[model samples]
Target chain A: MTRTVLEVRDVQKSFGAVTAAKDISVAVPEGAVFSLIGSNGAGKTTFVNMVTGYIKPDSGSIRFADRDIAGMAPRQITRMGIHRSFQIAQLCNDLTVEENMLLAGAIHGASGPSFLRRAHDPEARDRAVATLERFNIAEHRDRLVPELSGGVKKLLDIAMAMAGDTQIMLLDEPTSGVASDEKFPIMDLVMEALRSTGVTVIFVEHDMDIVTRYSERVLAFYDGRIIADDAPDEVLLDPEVQRYVTGTPA
Target chain B: MRSKLFLGATAAFAVLAAGSVILPDWAMFLCAMALAKGLVCLGIVGMMRGGVVSFGQGLYYCIGAYTATLVANSFGVSDIFLLTLLSALACLLVGMAFGPLLSSYRGIFFAMLSLALSMVLYGSLSKMSVIGGTDGLNIAAPTFLGWAPEGRPLQTALYIYVVAIVVIAGTLMRIYFDSEQGLITLATRDNELRVEYLGASVRNIMTYNYVFGAVLGGIGGTIAALALGHVDPEFAFWTTSGEFVFVAILAGYLSVPAVFVAAIILELVRSFSNLYFPNTWQLALGIFLLVVIVLLPNGLGSLVGRRKGNAA
Candidate 1:
């Protein structure tokens, strides 16, 4: 059996009158590519937030490398090698694409951010460029983030999250904002780049085609609970998943 | 790029240092005062890069002047270097004590909190009779190391001393602005949440930036105190802090060297306008600032070259 990289047991979270997560539990094996599918307000992003420590679960045990990170701060969780990219690309818009990548490398470098070393020192620049190149956005490295295309920004966001010894990456919506024709190409680039690094990927996606194509396993969420969890083909065929998540008549 | 900036800064420092020989005594004093105030404005620019503006920088400025004056009067320390050192240390301690609290604030809250703290200091200092009450205390002419120069020589020594300090501070700050931590600060300004998600503590970064600002403010206060031969609670007044903010906004957040250039310009305009316009000098300064703001929205530093993403 593949070793589990992330284990969430009986997680429960609520926001006042609304329940965002209820008894959510799932175990992700090392190097597995899993996709989360759900309708709006169906607790897909909530699970990612809890795992990445953006929102503390009201009660749950989130184990990553034998440590309970259920309520840890986002920065601490990030330092421990669990990084996540936002649904809306969270980038430094004022910085050039290369500078943004350099910042990520510098922050995650062995020495951390330094007062003495230049941010774009040769070593850091090479690493940043390499990551940008891997994401196929190296051509736009000199352009400011706001000037870049939506697809490139999303790619940069994922590329930045991939920096520093990341073992598990949770992409909220990698292809949400990309144009239809460009979505498949961007996802191909992102998946190809991510898979080569052997990092376990957990992506929340609304595109059934992407879910069927990229993910090995699928977790379908409805009303803050996982309605079905199985192979993409099996999950797509499940009556409850079709009715609740995909909005298709069963 | 780094080497080019270093060479340019060194050349500028040399030119300013040489000004002591050709400039008259009054001009020398004016330049010294301008540079000293420029140092305080530099601190404001530092905080501005981190996406917060401190309206109470006068708190550290006043503290530095008083610390130097107190040390010289009570402990008999007359060396300018020693006084500036002590003042910087004092401000560093104060910054450390207050940084964590202030780091939690942002936007207008941070500005107002800093302003309130400085006003508190101003009120306390005004009421303290032992420190000469509202009249303030006079600081004696400071000695360089052990040498005591009188009159013109003394003014020249102080002018050269201010020039050297400004150059050193400006050069060091330029390196800092280009450093990894400095880039993190600029990133924080743009998207703080993204910075946190990148595994860096935004609060810690803000705290460090605040402490640096405090230390620079302290040093500037010491230089100003020495140049003016006096210390007063007015140093902590809101209006005095407002002048530092004005210089910072005028300088923009782009370049460290532009900060001093803006300060020097403000001082020159104030002096000349007072001579020519008299009662309308404030109006003249206001008009000049408006013109600069309207023409160069990014401040004079834009004339140099725009560095992508707030690179100082």
Candidate 2:
């Protein structure tokens, strides 16, 4: 079972006059931290969105867990053990951290008599507590998401993606807008929390330091195309990659 | 804790039932009608909690009343329970038919679309000949399980019946607000996009909520029709739906019991203003709404507490 978890080949997408992804290909291993680095409008997010079924690639194939899911709905993709975390931490701000955890888990956990069933059924509650504890934010269990600090919010966002049987995750800028001092710790906590799940994570990030530190491999984007794909150190020093990375303060 | 809630609800309902027995005829009538209004407003609050402020709830309310009236007139069936069920069924069917279209909209679009649909119903009711047109249709005296009581006994039985329905419904609604489906409804208000990522169909969930709201609203309307012994085009009017929404906002969309409390307070406020100010009663309602909106942005429930995530 050395098969790739996700495969994207010759994917191309354009919005009227603007091309978001052009002649790109990627194959993520079963369980590895793969990072994408690019500047604003460099198509990193567009690529992630396409993989997660938010945007249909103009021409290409996207296979996940042995199934071609190129044109599926976001919900359908998520139900197939794939989840996406937003750049700004798309959480139910009106709900408590515990409530959010339970709500995320409720999708595939129970099905019948939703009105009569307890949302945080004993099993779901235990799993929620376990997830919160794993992310090291159990202290904020009863706290509203709006009351959370940026680091915790980011971690919670990723943790929510892990609440289900998420075999693959597409995290878009998990550390964006986070406090500089807390960024590494948040990423470290996320890595630690999700380590046991053996989840394959594909993250789009702008921070070179974070990309080099946590990711096993890196994909650098330039002009809506992948210019470099190798080990973090090799891709970091590549002349073409350096020009894109050093030229813009992404 | 669950037992405590169960017991507390039971105790509160017992007190209300007892109070209705000891109170005079006018007070009992007021309480019965207020409970019905509360039920309708509760449905609005249900949608309100999901960030969907519907102004077309009057459609279901009117359907509920008219369904009961039609069945009574057409088939001479006056069983209150059966009439309530028929009204709920009618609203459920209509809600299912229209829910898919309306669920895709949010904010002002959702609100205006709902208002427009209810207005369509209102216009139809005003022009229909078989449904008594603008003059409205008359409902025969309702019976309970083949026993049609007259005068005091009738009022007493109906009061008990209303109390039972409200109490049971309130309890179920409480359970619903805590359930996963209910929590997602609240979550839909927070971020529908995230709800979709969680692998739940946002529109479908909202549609179910809308249909549930319509069902309860229909039940409320049927109760009102039976209590008043009349069904009219005015029940489907925008103003009537506005009153339900106003009460929902005033109540803060906080809890099930709070809905009943808000409706009773609203009815009392209207009754007192009409007695004291006569022609300016509507003006008083407007002023009260303004004051409530300004003072309690979260509605009257916030006065107690605004605990985070208590989007009940």
Number of the top TM-score candidate: 1
| C-alpha lDDT (0 to 100) for residue B183 of candidate 2 | 81
Model 1: clashing residue pairs?
A: none
TM-score of only chain B in every candidate structure? 0.97, 0.96
Question: On a 0 to 1 DockQ scale, where is model 1?
Answer: 0.69
Query: Which candidate's lDDT is highest?
Result: 1
Error of model 1, residue A36, in angstroms? 0.7
Per-residue lDDT tens digits for candidate 2, residues A74-184, read 989998988889999989887889888988877767453277778867877888888899989988888888788988898888888888788888889999989999889
For all candidates, what are the clash counts?
0, 0
Best by DockQ: 1
What lDDT tens digits, residue by residue, belong to model 1 across residues B1-312?
788877988898899999999998888898898899899999889899999999999999999999999999999899999999999999999999999999999999999999999999999999999999899999999999899999998998999898989988988888888899999999999999999999999999999989988999999999999989999999999999998988998889888889988998999999999999999999999998899899999788778747743433
Query: Can you tell me which runs of candidate 2 are displaced by over 4 Å?
Result: A108-113, A120-123, A248-250, B304-312
Expressed as tens digits, the lDDT of each residue in A1-250 for candidate 1 is 8999999999999999999999999999999999999999999999999999889999989999889999999999999999999999999988999999999998999978889888878888899999999999988988888888889999999999998889999999999989999999999998898889899999999999999999999999998999999999999999999888887877
